[model samples]
Target chain A: MSDSTQVAATPAAPAEVPVAVRRAAAKPVSFGQVVGRSPFVPYLFLLPGLALFVVFFAWPAVEAVEASFTDYSIVNPLHVVGFANYTELFHDEVFLAALGHSLIVMVGLLPFSVAIPLWLAILVNRKLRGIQVFRAVYFLPVITSMITVAVAWNYVFADKGVLNWLVATLGLSDAPIHFLLDPHWALASVILVEGWKGIGTYMMIYLAGLQAIPGDLYEAAEIDGAGAWQRFTRVTLPLMRPFMAVALAIEMVNALQVFTSVYVLTQGGPNDHTTTAGYFVWSQAFQHYRFGYASAAGVVVWAILIALALVNHRLTNGKQANTP
Target chain B: MSERQVLRRRRGARWTVRRIGVYLLLAAIAVVFVWPFLFLLATAFKAPTQDVYSFPPSLIPRPPVLTWLHNAWTQIPFPRYLLNSLLYVLGGVPLFVLISAMTAYPLATASFRGSKVMFFAILSTMFVPAELMLIPRFLVANQLGLTNTYAGVILPGVLSAFGVFLLRQAFAAVPAELGEAARLDGCGEWRVFWTVMLPVVRPTLAISAIFGFIFIWNDFLWPLVVLNDDTKYPIALGIAYLTGISGTDTRTLSAGTLLSLVPIVVFFLLLQRQILEGAKGAVKG
Candidate 1:
């Protein structure tokens, strides 16, 4: 089955075609000839998907924007509040703290999403036996649900858990740290779990990038009497910039929208220290029934994410030009 | 021995030592990655008399029991959640793949008017983060009276840019000659798409299905928002609900969480090769 599919999927083998036929085939076929000459055929095929996209995405997106400008809620009738929701968001201490916490999470996640994963990818990008096993093991967390991960981590963050035991054994602190309960440590603990769960995905991305790098470049570097560290610094790091950009882009989006872990682990707890932008949106809308306020907050996050994505694109493309 | 031979022997010994060190380092990291699941496993089966939390975490549940597993099964609607998750994957993945293929086929093969515009419009959905969509999507669903329905949970998620993008690449890779040959046989475009094109791109379809299965199975937030009924919860949400009610019953919670993980982990393990390769292909594309 696969062989037949491969044959069909591949372009017409050059050897099988006569010179005349090949020459004739060189002329591009018109789209009309391919599907009965009716322009509506393609539209028919696209109808279901497009319909869903409009109903689910386009409609909702417009509603989100429109709802943001008004004081909308399930209980109260909709009223146009102009920029009140946005203005209130700026002044609201909780929302500002939530945004600040999201920023910290994004920065804290850099090592997990970029540096640590790159190192792990390099370590595992070897020809040794059973290396695939290591890759699969690392990727385990990526496949599991965040809820399950949070539940598993609860045991680790418990008062008499493995983490506390390790810290005490290492003489880091006298008393056990209340990782989820303490306001000071709650956000950091949430970040740790989020980062830990994400390391696998970023590691795989780096591994893909690493595998794409030509081996002969390293061989050439070795021939030039460059040591391993120098080879990595000079050849590997530069080639890896594109992959790093991809990782950072994904990490930023993920960090900004970190609700599941916060929900499962801390619930913005111990005085809302762990509340993030994503959590704030959920809490305002669902928990407190402030749909308009939440929509406004969501729009701000959406704007920031788009801006970050644009800046990342500019930086990566700009650096690519400068390097070569 | 000659001096050169002695030098070679010394170098071989150093290489062996380095190999051992690398292996040891890898094993340690592997443990760090796998330890949590192992702990969950141990805790789920832990005897009632054994302390779940200890200073030096004892992982080996001495004379492990099935009491917590029983509790996890009977205390909540575990079977109902499992069945709902199964139904979701069954209802969602096929439709997801089919819609992606249908959408991608025209975009990939035909050069119709507004094709590029349509493609970008679909691709632009990738930027609209799910978190940001929650409130208004809920409002839309509420307006449509889809809230608390199975369709509400499954419909919004079936269409994704990633699936369309991946399937577009797959459809584009197929030789045009095959379609031409089928057309010569008086096959309509629909027949060509269903029989000729789809079978040829079966592997890509499989890849899409695997990803869809994992996604729909583990979808938490959308279902949580859409469905207020506990009986309709998927396994992931079910586990969260379990955690909420079980509170400090760590053993039962661990058991429930472990059970929730079984289907996904097993699916992943079985298709790890395809999934890992597909992950790379996804990024490169």
Candidate 2:
């Protein structure tokens, strides 16, 4: 049986054909022909994945939309309350604060997610020995669980933690800042951790963009007597705009949904200062069991995300067109 | 010295200085990335008499001890949680890869009637944020009698847009000739796919598996939502549980957290090259 199978698998017949002729002939014979001409075979292959997608994603999405309009809870009988949740949410101080906090996290993350990562990528783009080791070290936090990150940083943010030690030793502050306890510092502290954990990912994205740039472009800029900064601005920046857009878009989405750090670091406490829109949705549904209200808030957050993505798309495209 | 030779030596000195400056800068930034974990490790092993936080932040333990590690292990079902995490990864990743590959195979190799539509529809799932899906997906799982079960945690996560997207790209890159030759040998589509196409994309398959392993291992939120029983909690969630109970004992918390990180970190160290390369490929696609 093994001998027969081996004999049948030989490709000697196709090898005899001229390369160009074989290439031309191969174009018409799709893999479906090899699959015994069954039109249903493809569907059969796709069935399991499509079924899971529908059950988990599509159905849940539709239910989310429908649940937003109803006063649904774990205990109560569902009743239609069209737009009341939305109206109330706009007026709700906590929800609005959460939205504002999400925005703050987004803005706070910009330097880490964009600027610093770009600089790091450029620095690491060299063809030096031990560079890959440095790259892996930089990316270590991105792979570690957020729970672990939060725990590790707890030591860093303790009353007498390294950060406090630095501040005090540098004479920046006489007293230690309550990094996770004070309302003023709590959200910012969470943002700092979020940004720190995320720099590696953004750096990797920028490194990918950097590696794609041809060496000749830099050589050409050098031949023109362009300095390093001038070459970066003239040749690299324009080419990297698309990557920046990607990094910015990802950072925005991540910031808007900042929950794990908030959960682990502050639990959205100290007067709800760290309460982001993502955390609000989770707390409302799971903590309060207000499924409908949470769904409404979720829909609003989803809308904002989509709108921001669209605005980002337009701005990136507009800038691309404006550049010489 | 000749004028040209002096000029050359001075330029070379400056170049060496600049290279040293770059290395110093890189090492400094790497410290920023690595210091937290190092501090965690130091705190975990520090003797009980030693202060975990101090002026200037001493990172070296006076004498490392295993007391906290033992406490972390014995305090709350640590081994059980680790096993649960292993179970989740083992249960989820294979299905994730297999489903992704099976789904991608047809979309890439055959021109079915709705292949394009199917691809786009699946791809759009990436935009639906997990926060948005939380309530309804939980409800769906509840309806399916899946909540509070391992399947609930594993099933919804097994099908991700990233996996499908990555595998589709991989499958499409396979040459058509291999599949054709197998077919000419009177092999069926399944045989062709199993023997020819799949082997050709083994590197991509390994990449997907590595990503899947990392994702499932580090996942916290969904498992937190799905599992009501503490016994079923994965290591990440278990560490959070440890933090909640161990409150002020930073040493024990650090030890538990460090313990949870070990497997994933070792796995990453072994496969960092593939991971870093795969990350670039993922973005470009």
Candidate 3:
């Protein structure tokens, strides 16, 4: 989310302590000083972590890019195809459908990620009793495994389950609608589950933003005869821009990488109607052993993520500068 | 005085109504979030005669039974799967936390030659989607002969930027003075890190551990990719397997799913105070 960077940069203690003590202590002379002051010590500290990173992230990332250019079936040695996989992907129906599906999910999640969660944050941000308990209750979904959540919702989306019952009772539909089995409803249903599970996360992020806002700003606005809506529009929303930016960026990444829910719930089923880019990669690589093709799709997914991230970065950057 | 008192009384009445409205809204939202789990709980206990799905969908299991729970356990090696999960968490979380702390220590305290580069390098890893890395990572593990093994599942997860980033924040939050004091006492960087720095960030370590536990416990895709043997399947995958076997029987599936969830949920509830605070602090960034 880049939230780590933002949070890490916040200096914990006030800068009352002078730099002299730190500098002096950093260069303390002793037998240990021989080891401590060496330029190699930091590398020593970083060695194990960096080694794991090399083996897992760095090397594999390079290999993934490399494999994307090659026809590397699991049963055969790699053969360089020179963008054949990518070109094939352009015409691949499932790949195109997966791309479209991922976009739909990404777009569909905005309300839950941005708007509803903001409202949720505001509601739970009140000074009512047992508020934390309610916050925890809402966050239960986020903590639980996606498999468990998917299973829980499987019944909820059953033809005669609670959702259909609610729809029928409200006169929203004429009959009980099959949510997961119907191709039109499957992707939307999965997206809803993804959104529902993630609302707690976004809510907490917005809550932090809401709480950071000084109450005196609201009190001052009230004194000036601004009602709740005016205070929210004038004071709260503007101040929460940075938090929303972070949330949006995170949501885009999360929504793009949605796999567990799709795997557990729909398996990109009902004629590939629910195959996301992430799920497509898995299907290609694991299910079919099309390593090169999967790597190519993976590269596409990576490119899309980078593009979205850059766009979000620019948007948030401009807004944040204007605010602070 | 009477006029002012009457106005004050009316304001109090309005506030009460508003408070009641707020509570109702909160309750409604809570129900939306909690109902699925409650339904899961009910279905897991429902007797065979009770309809798991009906026109109105009854949640109360008339004469709940444990037959399904017994079936779920016996049908699959549920205990074995649980043990595999526990093994992954135990083997993975500690190493994950330690590596993260080590990586964070230098970034927080030292202005090394390549510290900035190192920090960005680690942060950049977050951008590499796990979905993309799945194929290549599995290949690397294959080349290393780690496939179909515990190390394959656990090692790759230890290298996450989330842990390093969170610990970096915690380590940086510690005042430089504590580090200085230890250094002045002739402590080496290692001693300073182990005795001086890490202890101060113990709560952050605990937070990292909790996160690591939840992640390794619930992890599905990577483990699914790396491990081929059914015997090595963790509980998350186990639940998926159980569903595959009992496709139509809601009772058995619910019991298995519920069983899979209980451990982590209980663990979370027990340590919820700390976990929630950690969550808030994480997003406060």
Candidate 4:
């Protein structure tokens, strides 16, 4: 056949060609040749995700920093104000209180996220019948929407709800405590709700770690005459340190991002006791229409998170543990 | 019986008692974890005349009625909001999974330059707190004219570093021989990836899909910030709005909350195994 006829008669290549064509021909027609050769085939695969990361994450993150310095409203033209927003954030009492409350919630949630979940993990780790059922039940809250969780907790926190009834029946107090309405109790109640919802996640993480421990270790410990508590303390606790580090990191991230519960339960209210840093940022941006100022506060919060993460890293000796 | 036999019997009795004690502990903790939901279910069905909060805090609904559910259905655009949430989940999850897979494929198999850089870049995004990103992300969407649009919510959510990382691990764990076999058969890299590799990592995809579904369905703040119009509000936001209405009663709120939770809770029940395995693999992987 003539060369022109051969070129015309050859079948069109499929779109899903490989980078290195193995076609059995003297002159191979590779995808690289057909599509114009470049070393970016891998990047071509990465383009969609990278585009999203740039537009949604990198671009916005840059804008967050820029907005923190400028006086940009949604409607108004932007003006570079040179750290005025940051200065204002320092002076803003609500911002300070919000920062304080965020820290408080983080500290408060450690018990729920680390300690109680570890306890629950140990309890459920036993080879009991229907253990999976209990696990599934415990995990229900973690999967449910936060709005539902907040609403459910609302009933339990109501003045005449089960909690108050229990307290009264126990003679702890004669009068009902308005859990969500009283400033003294609102933050604690919100923290409790957040912690309750989060227990399952941490528990599952610990359970996985517990499951990884060989049965022989426990048996060996038993043979050594180590008591139950002693086995847990000496065997399980030492083995669980890495898992705890991972859980602690995850918990810190979740606790600092505590907005949905506050929004649904208290609206960060009863005199701003539950207004976490996350809520403060939202209120500034959406409610007060201070987008620039909110961006500044976001930067501050982000810095704090980074610092805390670094500290956690130092504490954990920068171990290359998997993050849950 | 001998003294040794008596000692063995007493020890056996103590062991049984300890097992019973363990069962009791599990039962009590289960009550603590599950009671709120039970209370919610009870309140949703209780009649308006029924005291939801009595001195004893009863869970049994006396003369359960569906009136509150009906009221909640009418009070807001519940069905529309449900559709919106379904739209978010349906639109967001597959794209999220696809993008995650595409990103992970090259990172897993490609020996090209800058692959590690790309991996670390994605990892860094994990540390960028979600709350901090809200304002700037909203602004970026506005600049792109995606504000108040479903694309706005779905597109940003498509890039989940956790999904990408998990899928990367999954994809890497598949033997290299599989890809080489497909390649020798004149199957292109894309074909090898799509047909041969994707199936191997199907479990990871399912795991990410379930998580993506949960996240998108329950994502309140991002959708709240992006979509100004209440008509486009997801179910979570709709429930929040319902909670805001002064006239919305407890029974109605309870009903609305229950309705909002059903789809994902049911999903969890159906796919609990995959999710729990996914959680475990996340640590181990």
Candidate 5:
């Protein structure tokens, strides 16, 4: 900041400027002057974290993109496949199936993860007694490990397990029907588990969004003789639009990338009906040793996610943008 | 009664009925939801010869016993697997917490060159499916001779993008003035963070730690892929081992799986409040 003045103020300035400016130039620059009066120690505090990001995230990404172009298949191992893998992936039936499953999962998870949870948050948002206890109880599965949750559910859904036991006594079916391992029931089983575990988390998020809205809006709605439905549609839903967009985006991304649940529950089995893009990618790359094809699949998943994100941004922001 | 009073009274009664209806709906749903867990628990306590199905879905076993738990213990190295899981979680969670916090602080506050781009790069990494990185990660691990070691499982998590993103949101809230004062007081950069900013984001740290514990403890795929030794098997892997075999008995498999989840469930019950509070505060914050 002071560099120009110091250069101009030199007493023996060689006709570059007048003596008055030259004198201003002679003052020395101190470390404090350069870095400001604040501590340089925070940067020191951040050094380790910065190094870790480099090792884990940055390094891994660089390697992954590079690996994509090659014949990085695990079975045959990595080679330079160029665009062959990408071209081949377009026609690959299993890859397409997995991609379709991922989309279905993302599209389906919204109501369970976001909508129902939002409803739950609103229900408990009342000034009722013991509601806080319900909040904790509902959120129990959210904190539990997915592996344990999935495994536990597997037993519960066994051919002769509790669910079947319940169904049999009711005479709902002739015999025990499969849940987790069944071709027909596997994906549905996954969805139920996903919803149970996720609803509580997004409920909290919706609560935050709800709390941010002014209480007076609802009070004013009441003053205007609006009923509960009217208040919700006019005041609550409109105000919550932005949060809905965010919550949807968050849950969509999470559901699309689901692995542990699918992995532990079915491993994309029952004729690969439940196989998601993530499992497909894992199998193609690691199990089958086809890294190039797997990388192509990864690129496809990335494309879908980015497209959905952009579309969501546009839909959410379009009205606001039009208003301005 | 006045008309308004009569209306409110009638409405209140109607509201009570509707609420009861809602409550019943929720209760029935909760029953369907929680039954699987109940089934597993009963299946765990049932004897081998006993039919695993619960008539009327008995949450309680008529003869609650430790026979299945005992069989599972003897059949597998149950204690050893539990120890391995505990060991991995112990090392993994703290390591992830510390590393993520460290990375998050600077990225949140720094004015270094390429800072915005750096932050975006990290955020974009979250968009990529984790499975996409598995082969490359395994390759790197194989090259480093880290496969089957704690290093393989631990390193990928230690510098988690999500953890960094989560913590940075908190750390960024530390006022610049407070940091300046600490610096002027000769605390150094380390002390300013440790003494001033660190305390402010303890909730975030706690939140991240809870998630880190869950993720590290429950990790199935990476552990399945990397850790090759039976001796190194974590509980999740052990549980998978029980039910994953083809044509397995519904009884023994269910029994073994339920026993495996007992520890994590117990942990969840103990920490449920803290974890929920932490998670709610975090995304909301």
Candidate 6:
């Protein structure tokens, strides 16, 4: 609007600002000058997004901290209560059990997420037709909702579901496997679901890493009479380290927050066997009306995650300096 | 030169059995990865006797019928949900792409004052889990009187930090001289951005679009919390309703799951090639 007004008043633009001043400032700026001229433009572009980040991401985290120290209930309303919720969570056995289960699920899922995906990516990365279809087929669950995957899979693993039907027919068992309903299988089931969702994503990451390596490395090795196994062992393994690190780190952090599947499939049910730290927090805040306690749990989860991130950062940094 | 070929021939003969064995193993694993879908697809068409699992499991329905599929189609009005999903995705993704690309350009390319603070501010958001925003987001939506509306569902997701990061990486990787050359060729600032800069990163844009489609399509939590009307829900939520009734009405429920999965499956098949390329780009970028 203002630009149009200025264009309209150009003949009489001296009224806005004198042409004498304009001529003084009208000397052409250098190419180097333009790089520094719009120092504020980038900031201006970033301002709205930065504001959103702080409000939705950063501020809610701060709010979670405050909520943890208060006596908040969905039914009775919230007010200050110094350390009451934290104190309660510390003593709760089920909360402890849920926390343990979360760790167990993380442990069970980490190797599968990193190792299995990398293996599969390597196997399918060969020069072959329909490999693209294989990748797409594998990654379908990843792009789909973890929620739907959990629900559909629940039927597939049900007592009278397809898995059990197959198991019985193979003479593996006389009856259906109690995958979801049983205590022993419940947490493992959740981890398996997470691994399934993640394997495709890891495959893509590994594929990218593999593609980035120069073909000359393999060609040069082949000219030196290196066998396929020798080439893969000496070349692929070393080149793939960075990708493995990234894949491992991401899978670790993500597995900490496995909520959707647990919420939908288990609902913290079958004697609370499938509850992870995330679903535990959800149940506390939303279901049981214990916002204060849930917030404390959230804080604990955050701290643990932060500590692991720090350790990973330090280890990776150390290695980066030591290696090329 | 021929020594390499002799080595290859000897090794190929030696590893023939092993290569075939490996392929067989991979094929078996592929079958396992795909088994659930096959079962679900069959169950969607199975009759009562066919649906029920016994000692001898049936791979295919002895007499397949569309009864369950018909029931599922009518029960949830699956077509309405697809329309709602299309409206939601169409309204949100392009806006997100624009905002993300525009916002990330300066962060990536230009040298500016206080850039670190802005960069820090953006990076910090990546760690905040989506679960953390439940109450405040609800409060914000309610204050705006947008509860259960399209605005509520689409607005928050459109301004993602991940999108900004993705676009920034793309824009930053472009040669700066091309941008300078464009500017010297008599382009305006907006022209330089839209005409000169955007085309260089078409693959990144495609990646963002595919990502936006997936995340928005399958989302259930925000919709479950925000949208009350079943008709406003995306296809996944519609399927959740199937689960809600899957316990009681087995046949109809199986059909509903299949109906819900069809769009995603069709989409995967249609864009399988582009999706693979997009995945590769994701790794590179």
- The number of the candidate with the highest TM-score is 3
Model 6 Cα shift for residue A318 (angstroms)? 3.5
**Candidate 4 residues A124-181, lDDT tens each?**
9888888888888888888888888877876688788889988988899878898888
Kindly list the per-residue Cα lDDT of model 1 for residues A1-324, writing each as its tens digit: 112332333322222223354346444553344443465878888999999999899999899889899999989998999999999999999999999999999999999998899999999999988888888898888888889888888778988988999999999999999999998889989999999999988988888888988889999999999998999999999988888887998899889999999988988997989999999998998789898898899889988988897898888888667442
Candidate 1's residue-wise lDDT over B1-285, tens digit each?
A: 999999999999999999999999999999988888888999999998999989789999998999999999988989999999999999999999999999999898877788898897797677675766887888789999999999999999999888998889888888877876665554556666777889998888888888899889988999998999888999888888898899989999999998988899889999998887776656663
Each prediction's TM-score versus the true structure: 0.90, 0.90, 0.91, 0.89, 0.84, 0.88
Q: Which CAPRI quality tier does the interface of model 1 achieve?
A: acceptable
TM-score (C-alpha, index-matched) for candidate 3? 0.91
Q: Which ten residues in a row have the lowest lDDT in candidate 1 chain A?
A: A10-19
Count of backbone clashes, every candidate in sequence: 0, 0, 0, 0, 22, 0
Q: Report lDDT (Cα) of residue A54, candidate 1.
A: 92
TM (chain A) per model: 0.88, 0.86, 0.87, 0.85, 0.80, 0.84
Which residue pairs clash within candidate 3?
none
Estimate, for each residue in B1-285, the C-alpha lDDT of model 6 and write its tens digit. 599999999899888877777677777877767766666666677777754554444558768889988888877878999899988889988978887887788877765566677776665555545555566566666776878999888877776766777788888788876766555444444555676677788788877877777778888888887888887998888888877866667657767877777777787788777667666665454
Ranking of models by lDDT: 1, 2, 3, 4, 6, 5
- Residue-level lDDT of model 4, residues B25-133, one tens digit each, is 8888899988889989999999878887787888888899998888888889999999999999989999999999999988886666788888877976877767778
Looking at candidate 5 chain B, the ten consecutive residues that score lowest on lDDT are B181-190
Leading candidate by DockQ: 2
Model 3 off-target regions past 4 Å? A1-36, A75-77, A322-324, B1-14
> Which is the winner by lDDT between candidate 1 and candidate 6?
1
Model 2: what is its DockQ? Answer: 0.52
Q: Write the per-residue lDDT of candidate 5 for residues B59-114, one digit (tens) a residue.
A: 56667778767766767788998898898888888888887777677677656555
Measured over all alpha carbons after superposition, the RMSD of each candidate to the real structure, in angstroms, is 4.2, 4.0, 5.7, 6.1, 7.9, 5.6
Stretches of candidate 4 above 4 Å error? Answer: A1-39, A74-77, A314-324, B1-17, B184-186, B246-248
Candidate 4 chain A: minimum summed lDDT over ten consecutive residues — where? A1-10
Q: By summed lDDT, which 10 consecutive residues of candidate 2 chain A come out lowest?
A: A10-19
Score candidate 3 by lDDT.
0.85
Kindly give the stretch of ten consecutive residues in candidate 3 chain B with the minimal lDDT sum: B180-189
